[model samples]
Target: MNDLTINTAIQTALPATFLGRHLIDGNWVEGAETFQRVSPSHDTVVSVSAKGDAAVTADAIAAARKAFDAGVWSRISAKERSAVLLKVADLIEANVERIAVQETLESGKPISQALGEVAGAADLWRYAASLARTSHGDSHNSLGADMLGVVVKDPIGVVSIITPWNFPFWILSQKLPFALAAGCTVVVKPSEMTPSSTVMMGELLIEAGLPAGVCNIVLGHGEPVGSVMSTHADVDMVTFTGSTAVGKMITEASAGTLKKVALELGGKNPQVIMPDADLENAADAATFGIYFNVGQCCNSSSRIIVHESIAEGFVARVVALSRKVKFGDPMDPDTQVGAIVTAEHQTKIDGYVKEAVAAGAKLELGGGALSVEGLGPQFYQPTVISNVTPDMPIAREEVFGPVLTVLTFKTLEEAIALTNDSEYGLSAGIWSNDIHTCLEYARHAKAGTVWTNTWMDGYPELAFGGVKQSGQGREIGRYGYDEFLEVKSLVMRVGRDSRKPWVKASA
Candidate 1:
């Protein structure tokens, strides 16, 4: 692209605005308070949004409940629903550059990754549109001459979605499209830090012809807005993506109403490097696994469990890769690593590093805090720590930053034990040349997802989620739609006569 094109692409066509207010009943209304979105790279206020509290969040829940139960949006055919979603996808694609820039400025992610996420999110919408028609229920053959049995899936009505700041558009796309495809009305509570894109998404959905209230955006903190949405009596389901602590809170809040809850929480995933693995490939994979998106990913491989034979070599290679990573100017396409989300989060990450060091963990590469040259107070620089024990805070805690801890094991059993030591069971990666070892780890690893010979990869077709503390329920596949749906089993009497008398219960 030319210089003019490059400059123009990075700038948003839409004028910068406060974007304050929650989108309820098809219009924006200010809440009692407001929250500021600060640029993590430069520590400057980027935008602000109305801090939706319990009352305002209740309004959104009521609107979604009304849309699902009374409005025409949920009454449409699957094909018609798919058409609307496809339109939303198209509109997002048309404004990809603008949305990408907005996301980068707010979330402190690299502009290239942000653009890719925007495109990927748009594709997710289109994919869900196609899946709408494909995911109908199934019928079973009657066991006897007089009976017919079928299993049907139905939308669970109003859904409350609470998303995180990292990959703002992508996380929403993951939940919202599937919920829409399932014929459910949605109320989204985006992270206070990156609420701008979601608010803009409201306008795009409107332009895409989605009926008002079919999809709504509420901006605010988790305590009030998120808690209210999770506990709202009218909301039939709640889905959240964030830390384990917050995920637990959502589950607790939703318990009173018995809302269906789907959580994608934190992870302390392990990257196992076997003795026979390609050192170069493993090193590169390990680096990208932890450092990509500044290690803010739930499935990031923060723990490197390597065989003792190759520990030093692998650590050296990882340290080399860490040093070479470009960390600055999130808007630059060449920037391989970007800033952490905020100063508070950066401090938290640095604390983890310090605590780990105090606990006898060796800082192999970048450790401590770093401020980008041009940027004011960004958390840049890739970090890699070796000689780390499982007991170290950095090894166990989800720092949610670009910090990696390396540990060594002599035997496969030890490695497996170490990998399963964490409370999280989100995802793990095993790098090995041996087919048996790959299959063994894949079979025995205590994680929701496992990658053999690869790391930190995902697709729309594959399901994503966790098993233990990483959270419950799945997203991004058929399970994603299933999470938003309630299933009913239909059973009919096989014989008209009194041959088989059975007591039946009503659902």
Candidate 2:
């Protein structure tokens, strides 16, 4: 690793020259146009990224298709592919600091959190590597003595992956590594707002011996680039992580080609605090759920559904805890909350809070924009709102920021009702000591992932996804790998006297 130190003063340490290139067909190529990437913390241009148009996106798709059809990557042995993925994981571990710094600079997440996400990304790669070697087909002995039957899992060809701005590298790891492990070629489009880290990822994959045309990166807005990737006939699968609205768009666009789509979209996750629960611990868990990653996570517990008996005290505890959260320079290791992704996003979060307050939700704490000493006005104070009704927009919609809305439930049935009442069924949590109550609620909640006494806990071995409008299909674990694969069954006659009476009967 180079002994390059990032300047803590300006927070602009990345090389200006490494920015405006797209990785296509295993080569760094300049784009037809370029756009400046402004840091959310300081509002300064951090890098100029390549702007991929429809034609450029088509080129990337063609490259991936060629690689897949050529069988350069798809026909390779599973163990060999696993070896390559393991090397990629090794490379990522070696450059954790560098990648984390770039991620923090581009996405405005705290440096400590960024480092943790980078390490998580490396672990995801290693897990995908393990899956690659272990994944296998099946043979049936029950087919009878005259015939043999086999079922095989094969790669689904070129995959187009679109990742979001928040947790850029981490989300990409959830999709890309597994796709590659399954022997699929890929064309990726990271969010234009934070493409720097992903662009560097393309370089790192190449260094780790990913074959040319096997992995391609296109940097641009969703307009021509994302649209092309979704509708392109050559692309076999599209896995996206972002808003539910955009996930719907991708699904509609993919209808033209009937491509396989796995969408990990938005959420209005609820944290239900039962009357028997520990108020202090529940408050702390709620704070972590809605504030971590600046509450930009899809599975963020934005809604706090508390039993009426404990609602008031729990709300007060959450408000007091919100005050202790530090918001400042993203590069600082002590900063718990960092700047929002952009001024536009900050405005949207503010608008939600304002609308909620106007609609009779009481603002218990932090309700407006925050001004850090030297950082620009992109940070918003961690906010807590109480007296939120189920019908209120703040309670129903996704705020996508460090804003938590508190609602009270009179009974266990009411709590479960409130939890299931959403267009999103991504994630939900129950804070209770009663095993039977927790289990009942978990079974009834409409979410894909339910945490009994925890929030946002995940493992690569377990499947993750959402139900209803939260989008379709699963990610991570064997399910995530299966998303990039297709199953095929084969049958063959084995008996020497297998030429039976079919022709005689026809005659």
Please identify model 1 stretches exceeding 4 Å from their true place: 1-18, 492-507
TM-score of 2: 0.96
Candidate 2 residue 454 C-alpha distance from true site, Å = 0.9
Candidate 2 lDDT at 480 equals 85
Cα RMSD of all models vs. native, in order, equals: 4.7, 4.2
What's the C-alpha lDDT at position 195 in model 2?
A: 90
**Model 2, 468-487: lDDT tens per residue?**
98989999999888999999
Q: How high is the CA lDDT of each candidate model?
A: 0.83, 0.89
